[model samples]
Target: MMRYLIALMCFFTLQNVYADMTLTIMDQDNKPVSDAVILLSKESVSTPDAVAIMDQIDESFVPRVLAIQKGQYVNFPNSDDIRHHVYSFSKPKAFEIKLYKGSEIPPIAFDKPGLVVLGCNIHDDMIGYIIVADNSYVIKTDKDGKASLPVKQGDIVTLWSERFIEGVNTTKEINITNDTEQTLSLELLPPIEIMDHSMGYGFGKKQW
Candidate 1:
């Protein structure tokens, strides 16, 4: 009977070490920031096998910003009736899919960790971003700027947003613990530019 109690205690201890945490991000004005990426540092992380999609519709990428684990595949499907050219010159990965309509293009695998700025040769105004991460514990904030994930105590988590100033420190490291607040409010640096979402545009500027 004593051994059974000890085993149960060990199970509870493990649960405490890996607890579910909720993180909230805000801008300098205390407004909930959406589309912010949340990344966790984990030792046993591995590349995901699922293929993500970045579709183009109405001369614009549906989800202007996409977050993916390193070595994951991304399919660029042109939903618009007109042909579009997709390309990126970022260092992490550089490739281009020539003028095409629909999903005829093959999936591109992102093998490195960094931001891949996407653009089109034909449409000068269209822009998109693919943020490749090395760790599997990645989460993007919802419209309310909140995300929940299972995090271990002492684990460091980083946050990224395109709205941040180009040359500023955009990462936030938090030591997770049982006493840590579930809802953390952080004021980020001023944004380089803000897009009019109501007009169907997303975050970030045309520059790399």
Candidate 2:
């Protein structure tokens, strides 16, 4: 009898998660914008425990992006033979890890929900991002500029991007009961100036 009751509860929980939303984002010139982070907040936020990894490979932050729920942990592993220091100045989660090699350092826990801009002080060109979301409904747009997520109706919707200008509409409210699709226009700051392409990624023959 106890097993029967547990099975029924699980069924109802799964049924309530059918609220899915498909999102599309366009930049100032109406070009599909990738790497945009989507945040969904509910009156009660609950996410299964998760651990994310940001790998240091080829002198660059591989994947270049990551999303994790608030209070979760993130592992930054150096895949290259040389050492790399990872730090972020973003207000959401400002932290710095000393120069190190491999995953010997304990995984960092992102307690606050916010964006973390990662960089290697030694390797200026190596950059990455970590979006620590308060809610579990967090996902970044794909290279093709499309993504779908399961979000309950009446949840608050917020959008964030590194390219957003000082003054811009960065948040929006979303209501979805059934599967829905949306297209949005976003204003962004001017593109950043191109930087050097030959910067050492810590993997070259420099023999540090």
User: Number of the top candidate by TM-score?
Assistant: 1
Q: Estimate TM-scores for all models.
A: 0.79, 0.70
Over 47-115, each residue of candidate 2 has an lDDT whose tens digit, in order, gives 547667787877778657688888888888786888898998888778888999977778888888767
Candidate 2 weakest lDDT stretch, 10 residues: 196-205
Q: Which TM-score value belongs to model 1?
A: 0.79
TM-score, cand. 2 vs. native: 0.70
After the best TM-score superposition of candidate 2, give how far the Cα of residue 55 lies from its true spot, in angstroms.
Answer: 1.1
lDDT per residue as tens, model 1, 1-208: 9999999999998877665767777777888878788787664467878888887866887577799989999999886778899999889999999999877688999999878889999999898888788866788888788888677656678777877665322555766653334556665666434344444422221212
Best by lDDT: 1
Instruction: Give stretches of model 2 more than 4 Å off.
Output: 1-18, 43-47, 151-156, 167-179, 189-208
Residue 32 C-alpha lDDT in model 2:
78
